[model samples]
Target: MINNRYDFIMLFDVENGNPNGDPDAGNTPRIDAESGYGYITDVCLKRKIRNYVELVKEGEKGYRILIKADRALNSKFDEAYEAENLKKGQKGKNTDDVNKAREYMCKNYFDVRAFGAVMSTGDNPCGIVRGPVQINFSRSISPINIQDVTITRQARTTGDRMETGSTEMGKKSIIPYALYRAEGYVSAALANKVTDLSEGDLELLWTAIINMFEEDHSAARGKMCMRKLIVFKHDNVLGNCPSHILFDKIKVKEVSAPPRCFSDYSITIDADLPSGVELIEKI
Candidate 1:
C-alpha cells in the first residue's frame, strides 16, 4: 500500500494542432474567453491516461479500465455484484453487498483504484469510491491564438458534385503553439484506507502520466508531448507542506514573446525545499 502523499506538476505543449476542441463552438480549441489562455479539460487528460494504461497493461490482472468506450458501465457494475456473489441493492441505499461490489471493482480495475467511480446508477448499486488520485485542468501559461485552416478534398461525395468536379472544403481548428501546465495530487490516506492503491499502482500512475500522449497522436491534436513532470513526495501519508507552496517553488516564464517552442520559455526550480519533502523530476 502507498504510504506517502504526492503532488505533481505536468507541463505539455501542442504545436500546429488543437489540443482540445469545444464542440459547442464548432470544435474550436477550448480557451478562456476572458484571458485567451488555452484550456485542456481534466476529463480529456484522464482519458489519455486511461488509454495509455489500457494499452500498456492489456490483459494484465488488476489493470482493467472501468470507463472504457463501447462498454456499458451498468453491465460492469452487474458483473461486480455477480463476481462478489452478492444480491443487487435497492435504489438510494448502500448495503454490505454494495460495499463488497465496490471492493471488487477497486481490486480489479486500475482506474477505480486510482481515480474512483460512481457505480450507483444501475440495479447493482456499488457505492461511490473516492479515488486516491486526482488531476486538475491544464491551462496555458500565456494567451493563445486559434487559427482555422481550410483544406480541400480531391473527390466529391455526391454524384452531382462529382460530375461538376467540385471539391469538398473543410475547416480545422489549430493553435500555432502553446504550453500548458496541470497539477495533480495523490492521497496516501485515501489509497490505504479507501482504494487500496498499491506502490506498483502509484508507479504505474507516474508512468502513465509521463507517456499519456505518446501513443495518442492524431491530426487534430498535432505534435503533443509531455515536456516535464515534477513530483513532490512527502515523507509521511500526510503531506509536509501545502501544495500551493510547493507549486510556487517552480516558476515558468516566457523568455521570448509569441513563444512557438518549448525552449522559448524558461523553467526554474528552487533547490531549497521544505522539510520532509523530496522533489523528483520525471521528464
Candidate 2:
C-alpha cells in the first residue's frame, strides 16, 4: 500500500481542436465567460483515464471500470450485491450489506478505488466511497480564440438529398492552440483506510493520466497531447506542506503573443522544493 500523499500537475495542449465542448453552448469549446480562458472539465479528463484503463486492462481482475459506456449503472450495483452473496435490503437500512458491496466495488473496479462513486440511487445501492484520488478542472494559461469552421460532406442521410447530390453542411468548434494545466491530489490515508489503493494502483493511475489521450483520437479533438506530469510525493501519509505552495513553484508563461503552438510558451519548475517533498517528472 502507498504510505505517502501526493500532489500532481498536468500540462496538456490542443491544436486546431476542441478540448472539451459545452453542451449548453451549441457544443462549443468550454470557456470562462469572464476571463475568456479555455477549460476542460475534470469529468472529461476522468472519462479519458477510465477509457484508457478499460482499453489496456480489459477483463483483468481488479481492473474493471464501474462507470463505463453502454452499461447500466444499476446492473453494476446489482452485480456487486450478487458477487457478495448478499440480497438487497431497504434503501437506508442495509448499512452493513451496503458497506460490504462497496468494498467489493473498490476491490473489483479501478475507477471506484480512485475516483469514488455515489451508488445510492438503485435498488441494490452500495454505500458511497470517497476515493483516494481527485483531479481538478484544467484551465488554459491565457485566453484562447475559438473558431467555428464550416464543413461539407457529399453524403446525406436522406435518399432524396443523395439523388440531388447536395452537400450536407456542419459546424465544428476548435481552438487554434492552448496549453492547459490541471492539478490533482492523492491521499495515502484514504488509500490505505478506505479504498485499499495500492502502489500498483497508483502507478496505473499515473500511466492512465500520461496516456489518456493516445487512444482517444478523432477529428473533433485534434492533436491533443500530454506535455508534462509533475508529481510531488510526500514522505508521510499526511503531506509535508500545503499543496498550493508546491503547485506555485511551477510557472507557465507565454513567450509570444497569440501563441499558436506549445513552443511559444515557456514552462519553469523551481528546483528548490520543500523538505520531505520529492518532485518526479513523469512526461
The global C-alpha lDDT for each of the candidates, from Candidate 1 onward, is 0.92, 0.93
Regions of candidate 1 where Cα sits further than 4 Å from its true position = 92-94
In candidate 2, how many Å is residue 44 off? 0.3
Against the hidden true structure, what lDDT does model 1 obtain? Answer: 0.92
Per-residue CA lDDT of candidate 1, range 105-196, in tens? 99999999999998888777788999989999999999999999999888777898888677778889899999999999999999999999
| Model 2: per-residue Cα lDDT over 1-283, one tens digit each | 8899999999999999998999999989999999999999999999999999999999999999998777889889998888888877566477888899989999999999999999887888988899889999999998999999999987689988788777888889999999999999999999999999999999999999999999998999989999999999999999999999999999999999899888999989898999999999998
The number of clashing residue pairs in each candidate reads 0, 0
* Model 2: lowest-lDDT 10 consecutive positions: 86-95
C-alpha RMSD between model 2 and the true structure: 1.1
Off by over 4 Å in 2: none
